[model samples]
Target: MATTTESNPPAKDSKGLSSLNEFNLEKSILRRGLATAAEIDACKAHKAKLASKDESKGLLEIMVEARVLTKSQSMRLLKEAGEANRRVEIPGYQVIEKLGKGSMGVVYKARQTSVDRIVAVKILLDALAQNKEFIKRFDREAKIAAKLSHNNVVNAIDAGDVNGLHYFVMEYVEGGTIKDVLDKNEVFEEKMAIRIVMAVAEALAHAHQRGLIHRDIKPENVILTKDGNVKLADLGLARLTADEKWAMSEAGMAIGTPYYISPEQVRGQVDVDIRADIYSLGATLYHMVTGQVPYGGETAQEVMRKHVDKNTPFVPPDHLNTKLSSGLGVVVETMMAKNRENRYRNPDDLILDLKCLLQGESPMIAGQKPDDLATLAEGDVEDTSRGISEAQLIEVAGYVNGKQSVIVALAAILALSVITNVVVLATR
Candidate 1:
């Protein structure tokens, strides 16, 4: 996930051109520094010979081998060229000002000349356009965002490749993200915080019904309008159930912000579903209610470790802000339970509880205890089965009930044994 922060224009740097292909190598080399005639001729000859033999060797690799261009110099020029190329005018939009810039893309506040509509255009880094896998993921995000139509979600207007630069156009949300608001106002009013998160919860419910999971949910991704309305932004990390077969994230690597990541996400589990989003949303709400995030550490890895470690119990929001009710704290805790089984089973259930709280009624999930959390093994019945047979479900329920009864019976037997031993020793 990209970090959201306001900054001045990016300098002409090589950070954006880390994935340069062979095609741009020559120009990048020339721009870096003047090469002697012998050096240039030698590099060209080497490149030609390599291409003739294999026809697949990258120019940078061949040039570096020929000692014509240093790796650092080649990298520097690629960055400069990429920065200049991306600054060109877009096909339909007239660039106004940069909204924000990240390593992968720059979000520009632009106007569509044909329709004269203001839109936020996010242009991906030129280097990414050369990467086939990155293109597929970018297209996936665009397609998913375009299909979603909700008042509380940012709408994707258009997306396409322009001169090998992938860009997505979205409706311009005039206000800043929830993070921006929190920066100025440390904490929001209790009612206002609930309202904002409630809107986000409803939006998430809609996405969940369509088999979409917004893997990255944080205050940075939640935009707030001038009129106090919320719009969930940044579907770049979203995934579709149908596209799970083609998931791009590598094994052992999680795709989310550390501060708000769910326990399953921290463990890099592949079966992340809507419950992960619930955990993140709960963390976001926790931040909104208090001035601090739920977890904090010196590094991202440490924060993620905290998420996976049940011993590092989350401090309730009420503890941070004395005015917050214990009931509301329980609601957030249930949503952020370490185990998905302890969380709201579905987004609708979460929405119902949030709505209940809005109406001054006790939250439906207020009684969830830490002991209620249950962990499922990778190939367990609950993990693999989408739909359970009626008889199977009854059997499972009976097993669970019987297990509880067995636990109670065992405890009673142990206690009796202790008492019997005490009596025998006293008589002796």
Candidate 2:
């Protein structure tokens, strides 16, 4: 569709244009680092030279004539410029280039006018602009992101609407996402994966401390820089732990990617929290070490079904990747346990084990915790009779010794004490 030639000219503006200007193409190209100003000047001169012969030759046409740009490149630039002009108009930021487009919106690499710095701006898609739910979610995401401040988190800058078109700006990260590298067929080293995971864990810790839970923690949402800085991205699916009213409203809708979503999210549980994020980060770690998702299925529902199924066979990372250490594998398994109670209680604990694995030592926390035995049962597959296997029974027995059960026991003992005191007074 972008391969059209000059014969099919775009709607014309009156001639006598400033030499280097082509609507927004020149500015867009320069802002995106696609071409230099000198290169544009040369193309302008070429356009001027050929103007007498063909008055209709445009800036893009001249660039193609001089071999400065391929037809497809010129067309794509024109298309993006047209799109921006048609709908989006953020007041203080200049949209540079369309970075990407997804179901929710189009993200652009933009320059903040006042600060004169690069930022990424996400504009709600025109198709969804009138949807109240989408607009509310978009606004909420911006507000929530602005509350977080951490080195490993993408910083939110500004958010507003101009004539009904909404845009949210954030720090521009200049590297590929984990999913990008995985798509390129490049595999991450075990230690590198551990370091990256640890960085995200730190980010999650910051968010969790503030009572925010990032429901979607997939590889695509984690950006990795060449300098080894890992930024946890996209708080679109994040929710406040105390937002009971909002939680009830979204009670039954699955809210995250199937490949990395937690079991609680898959079930659309209202009480989903930081532990759900822990499960997703674990799934991401599993993909990082093995170069594959934890489970594969033809459909999203099939994949999500496996996440909530206790009977699903747990395949440890070392089983998939021979180079994986047992320590790192144990950490992944614990993080992705079918039961959130069996997973790491929080990112602080997860980070500790991740650090230990980064060293030559085994996980001093997750692998050695009191709930480690219950985590073991979470890693087992049930028998044909669909009942808990003998091994699972032993692991469940170990669970009575867990902290939650002990707290329950204490409450029960207090209740019994109160009852006994009342009986003695009545007897007297």
Candidate 1, residues 130-168, lDDT tens digits: the string is 888878878878899998999999999999987677888
Q: Name the runs in model 1 displaced over 4 angstroms.
A: 1-86, 247-249, 368-428
Candidate 2 local lDDT, 1-428, one digit each (tens): 12113465445433333222254567777866777899999987776677666765778777777777888987887676566545345777776656777778889888888988999999898878899989999999999999899999999999999898888999999998999889877788999898899999999999999999999999999999767799999888898999999999999999999999999999989999999999999999999878889988999999999999988998999999998899988999999999787789999999988888877988987755675546556864344377767877676566546656777898999999999999999999
Candidate 1 backbone collisions, by pair: none
Best by lDDT: 2
Q: Model 1 reaches what TM-score against the true structure?
A: 0.67
- How many residue-pair clashes does candidate 1 contain? 0
Best by TM-score: 2
